[model samples]
Target: MADLDPTATFKEFDADGDGYITREEFTAAMKARGEEVTPAELDSIFRVADGRDGDADGRISQAEFLVAWDR
Candidate 1:
């Protein structure tokens, strides 16, 4: 099994514990990781992982992010 728990990652990224990661929270999380994503890059990445079903709005859910990143 993968070592990471995507649910946990999601929780961490969600920040406000609101069950969703807003764009601001997402950017903050990346910055916390010492990553500086340009606006264009962030938008592109978000669009890719927003989920095919749109159940997550435009945010990447923990499970979805983990599976997508693991590849």
Candidate 2:
């Protein structure tokens, strides 16, 4: 399988062009991608992604996201 481009994925989720993916952005991105997630489930998903590598800043920085992708 071809590799997933973490930067591209991150860019897709960083809707605001602010170099960070907020919870709102993440939720919107997921919904736009046709992900069916309830509010609680979305929160959990964001929490896990934001929590990866111990980054709990409430927003996802590209660095954090890249590290989470192990790239």
Candidate 3:
């Protein structure tokens, strides 16, 4: 899985490689995975994966991706 891209987690979760993953996607990849999450969970998940510190920093780097996923 070294070729993995975590921020692209949604894309990977999309499975069929469609350009978009719908609420059903969120329901499956995130919620059904035991997140107890909802389709309306939050866009922040993406930003979080993108490595935004939300304190006016920049895009999340690859190292951040590893650390975040490691969580």
TM-score of each predicted structure versus truth: 0.69, 0.68, 0.39
Query: 1-71, model 1: which lDDT tens digit per residue?
Result: 23377677778789988776667888998788777878998787677777544664777666666666677
Q: Ten residues in a row with the worst lDDT in model 3?
A: 53-62
Kindly report which residue stretches of model 1 are placed more than 4 angstroms away from their true locations once superposed. Answer: 1-4
Task: For each candidate in turn, give its C-alpha RMSD to the true structure in angstroms.
Answer: 3.4, 3.3, 6.8
For TM-score, candidate 2 versus 3, the one ahead is 2
lDDT (Cα, 0-100) at 7 in candidate 2? 88
How well does candidate 1 score on lDDT at residue 45?
68
C-alpha-based local distance difference test score of model 3: 0.51
lDDT of 3 by residue, 2-71 (tens): 3366657745556566544444554566554566664345355545644444432323334454576777
Better of 1 and 3 by TM-score: 1
Candidate 1 whole-model C-alpha lDDT, 0 to 1: 0.73
Query: Residue-wise lDDT of candidate 2 within 1-71, one digit each (tens)?
Result: 02388889988889878999887887788788877557787677568767774767777788877876773
- How does candidate 2 score on lDDT? 0.77
